[model samples]
Target: MSLGTLGRYELIREIARSNDIVYEAWDPQLDRRVALKELRLPDGISDKDKHARKERFKREARAAGRLEHPNIVSIYEVGEENGRSYIVMEYLEGETLRQRMDREGKITPEDAVKIFDQVLDGLAFAHENGVVHRDIKPENIQLLPDGRVVITDFGIARLQFEPSITVDGQIFGTPSYMSPEQVVGRDVDPRTDVWSCGVVLYEMLSGQKPFTGDTVVTISHRILHAEPAEIDGVPWAIAHVVRKAISKDPDDRYSSAKELKAALNDALQGALTDSMGPPSPWGPPLDPYSAQSPYTYGTSQPPGTGAPSPPPPPGGYAPTGASPYGQPYGASFPPNMPMPPFPPGWVNPPKRPLLSPEASEFLLRTLIVVLIGGVLLATAVGTIAWLDRRSQEATAAKVDQALADEIAKVERLIPSDPLAAQQQLTELRRRAQSHATRERIERLLSRAYLERARRLLDAGTTDETLRQAAGLAQRAAEMAGEDGQATLDAGKLLYDIATRTTDPQDRFDRLTEASKALEVAFNSEGQVRSEAGTLLGNTCLQIALLFGDNKARSSLYLNRGIYYAEQVGNRKLADDLRSRL
Candidate 1:
C-alpha cells in the first residue's frame, strides 16, 4: 500500500534508522523540520499486537507532543493511513551524549555540571507534571551545537493512560544507568532521574561508567549492591555530588531534580571559587582558568629524574670568572671599589653640610608627621566607602522585605476578598518603582489573583467576579515580565474563567484569552509545557463537553487531552477521560 503524505509535510532525508522504526521527513508548511518515525511490523505479528502497537505509538506521540521544554525533543503529529503508522517530531541537530563521551573520553567538570543542570531542569519539570521518563541514558541525551542539552526518546515513557502496559518483569532501561529499583522491576519516581543523572555525571568525570560487567545480569547486580570506585584525582565537589546521586538506594539519592540541580550548582560554584585561589599540592589540580600555567609551575619532580636538561653553560663551558659553585667571580662585590677597612670608627675625611642640624631634624619630623596623616586619611576614606556600600545593601534588603511582607498579606487575603486584595495589590504596584522591585510585586499579585479566581470559581460565585478576576490575571500577566510562575498563574486564572462559564459566546471569548495567556506562559523562559498542554487540552475538552453535538468533536478533544496528559504522565486523569470514550 502507498502511504499518502501527512498534511503539507514532505519527506526529507532519512536522518536515523533503527530496528523498530525509521525517522525521516520535514514539514515546510509549518516551518518545522520533522522526524517521521515509521515503525516496521515484523512478520507473524498478530493483528491484536499490531493494534496495540499502533495505539501505543499514537499515545507516545501525543504524550511527547505536550512537553514543551528546551531540554526535551518535541512531537508535532502522530497519524496513520493505509496500514502505516507515522510520528513526526522535531529534527534536532547534535551528537548524542553517548557519542560525545566516546569521542572526548571524559567531559570537563564544568561542562558536566552545565549539561546535568539542563537534564535536571527538564526532568524536574516532567516529574512535577507527573511524567516519569523510564529510560534515561547517555544515548538518549542530545548535546546541541549551541551547548544546550535535550533529552529524547519518550517512546517507552510512563504517562497517565489506561491499561498501563507492563512488560512483566522485563527491564526497561540500559543496565549501566538503571536504578536498582528499575532493575528489580519495581516502581520508580523522580529520584530515578536523579540516579540516572548520577551515572552520567560519574561517566563524565571518571571517563568510565560506575558499574560494568561481562554480562547484563552482573551489571544489574553491581548496580544493586556495589559501591562505585573512589573518584580520587578528579574534581572533588563534583565527585561528591555524583556519588550521592548514584546511591544504590533511592532513599539515599536526591529526592527530586531540583535538589540535584541545587547540588550541582553548589558544586560548580565551589569548583570555580576554589580554582581562583593559589594552587595546593595536596588538593585537586587547578583548573586551567586559574593563575599560572600548570605546565610551568606544577609540583617539582625528584632530583635528576625527568628534569629538563639544564641549559648548556653559555658556550658549553664554564666561564673564566665563574666560581666552582657556579656563581660568577665578583658578582657579590660592591658596585664601587672600597679601600681595605681601617680600624673601627676611624675618621677619613670631612664633608660640607647642605643644611643645619636643627633644620634637618625639623624637616624629618614634618615628613614623619605627613606620612602618618596620609595613612590616617586613606584609612578614613576606605571606611567611608565600605559604610556606603553597606548602607545601600541594607536599604535594598529593607525594600525587599517590605515587598515580601505585603505580598504575603495579600496572598492571605485572596480567598476572603479577591477584588479588595487586587486593589491592595495595585497599590503595592504603584509603590514599586525599580524593575526588580516591580517584577517581584507583580509576581505576587499575579499569584494572588490567580488563587482568588480559582477559589471564586470553585465557590460558584457570580460570573461578574470571574470576569474581574480574569481581567486582573491578564493585567498581572502583562506586568509579570519574565517570571514563569506569574505567567502560569495568569494563564490558570484565564482558563478558570473559560471553564466556569456556561454562555457559549462568553466561554469562547474567555477560552481565546486563556489560549493566548497559556501560549505566553508556554513560551516564557523556564516555563514547562506539560502544565500548559494539560490546561490547553482541558480547555478544549471543556469546550467540546459543554457545547459540541457529536462524539466526533468530543473524541477529538479527548484524544488531544489524552495525548498531552500522557506526555506529562498524568496517567490517572488521562485514563479516566479515555474510559469515558
Candidate 2:
C-alpha cells in the first residue's frame, strides 16, 4: 500500500517489518529510488518504550551515516515530518543471503570463502570506525546483481563512544548468531561480530546452521554451551579457522575482523593446490550447481528446487563479470595469484615431454638413490630434534602450573585486597607466556583496579582522594580492553570524582580524562547511556565556559554538547546549551 510522502520523496510501497514500516520511495532530486524507514511504534507500547525506540532509530541513522564503503548500505538522510521519524537510504534491488541459501543449499567452499572475505572486509572497515554490528546473519547480507555484497540493517549497531541504546540484561540479536557473551548478557565488541561472521561462514560452507533450536531459549543455551558440529567436505585448515572465529570465549576468538580475514586467506592458500586452480574472486560464474551461466537473483534456479525465481528488476544492469582485483576477465595468470575457477569443461593441456622416456627413467632412479641417503641422514637429526621438543614440553608444563597458581592467588585477593591483586597481576602480566594467560591477567587487573577506585570514591570526596581514585579508574578503563563491565564502572567513577572537584583547572583536567573513559563506556549496553550523555554534555559546556575567549573553540564545544544532549532526548539540556550561542 502507498504511504504518504515523506519530505520530497514519494513513498511507493511499504516493505514488511513487525514493528516498523520501510517504504520504497522515489527521490525526485536524485532521479532514483530510495528506501525510507519510518520509526513508528506498534500499539500498546508504553510511552517510555516508544520514546526509547525513537531514540534508538535515530541512533541507527547516525551510526550508519558515518560509514562510507562499497560493501555497506549508504544512508542518504534522516528527518522527521510532523511527529513521524524516517531514514532515507540507497534502495537495493537484490536478494538476501538467506533467500539465496533457501534457493540453493550449501555453497562450494571456495565461493563461500570469497563471500566471507568481502563480509570481513566490510566488517573491518566498520570496526575501524568504532561501530559494532551486534546482529549479523544471512538475512542482513544483500547480494546485488552486479556481484557486489552489501551489509544492511544497522538498527542494532553500537557506536563506540556513544551511550548504548540497549538496556542492561536485555538480549537483542538473532539467537542462533549471538556470541556467547551476547547470549549471556555481557558487553560486546568487534569480537562479537567476528563470532556471528563465523556462524554465517559455517552455514554457507555447510547446509546447516551452526546453532539451531525450536525455541529462542533453547537456541541461546546451545550458543552458550554447545560446540558446532564439524564441517565436512571442506578443507581442514579453513574449518579450523572458522572454529577459532566462533570460540566460546571472546578472548579465544579473532581479535578483529581483519585478523579473521587474514587467517581465512592463509588457510585457503594452504588448503588449495596449484594444479586445482586458485579460488574464485567474489562474483558470478562461481556457482557450479546452477543451470544459468551466471547465478544471480531472479535468474534460473537449480532443477527440482520447486521454488520459482522472482523476475529481474526493471532496467536491471548486467553483471560486471569482471574481477575486482584489477585484472581483465581473461588475462594471463601470474604465479600463485588467486583467481576464479575456469569455466565448465575448460582444461589445461599437458606440457610437452622434457626428455626421452629412457633418459627420464634413468634420472628418476638417480634421484631415488640420493633421496634414500638423505632420509638416513635426516633420521639421525630427527632423533636430536625429538629430544629437544620433549625437554621444551616439560618446561612449558611447569610454567603453566606456576601461572595457574599465581592467577588463583590473585583472584582471591581481588575482593578484599584489590590494590595488592592489581600489583601482582601487573607482575604476572609481564611473565605471562600464553595469549590466554595474558588475557585472563588483563581482565583480573581491570577488575581489581576498578574495585579499588570504587572503594576510594565511596570512602571520601577530598581533592586528594578524588585524584587518587581517578588515577586508579583510568588505569582500570585502560586495562578493561574495550566494552567490559569494569570499563563502564570505571568511567562512571571517574566522571563522579571529576565533578566533585572544586578547582577549575583540576576539574577541567579530571573531566577531560573522564570524558575519554566515558566515550568507550557510552558504546556499551547499559542503562547508563542517558546519564553518560548528560555528564559528557555538561563537561564540554564547562570546558567551553572556562575558555570563552576562543569563540571558534567555544562554539565547537557548545555544538557538540548540544548534539549529545539531543541524542539522549534531553531537550531541556539541548536548549540550554543552545541558548549560550
Q: What's the lDDT for all of these models? A: 0.70, 0.78
Residues 1-581, candidate 1: write the lDDT tens digits: 00124444545345676645645554545645567887777886999877766666766676567789888888777776667778777778889999999999988888888888898888888887777787788988999999889998877676654456666776677789888888878877888878988898888888998999998867875776556776655556667678788776677778999999998898789777874444432233323222432433453543224434435445554335545685443234323435342222122122223335676567558757988999999999989989997887778767766777877788678677867887888898787645567676667677666766667567765778777766766676666666665666776877767767767777866665665566555554433566876776676567557545657546755775676567667787688668866
Assess every candidate by TM-score: 0.46, 0.48
lDDT (Cα, tens digit) per residue for candidate 2, span 1-581: 11336887766667767556888886756667799989878877898899889988988897789999988899999998878899999898889999999999998877777887888889999999999999999998989888888898888888998887778978878888998888768889999999999999999998899999998867875676556677878876778788888888787789999999899888788667642344434322333323442333455654335434344457753545556676543334444445554432221222223345676567558757888889998998999999987887677657766889879988999999998898899999998766567778888998898899889878988888888887888788778776545556776777677778888778866666666666665566545677767766887787678656867556766887897788778899989999997
Q: Candidate 1: give the clashing pairs.
A: 63-567, 160-570, 160-571
Name the candidate that leads on lDDT.
Answer: 2
Best by TM-score: 2
Which segments of candidate 2 are over 4 A away from where they belong? 274-581
Error of 1 at 183 (Å): 0.7
Error of 2 at 401 (Å): 84
Mark the 10 consecutive residues where model 2 has the least summed lDDT. Answer: 343-352
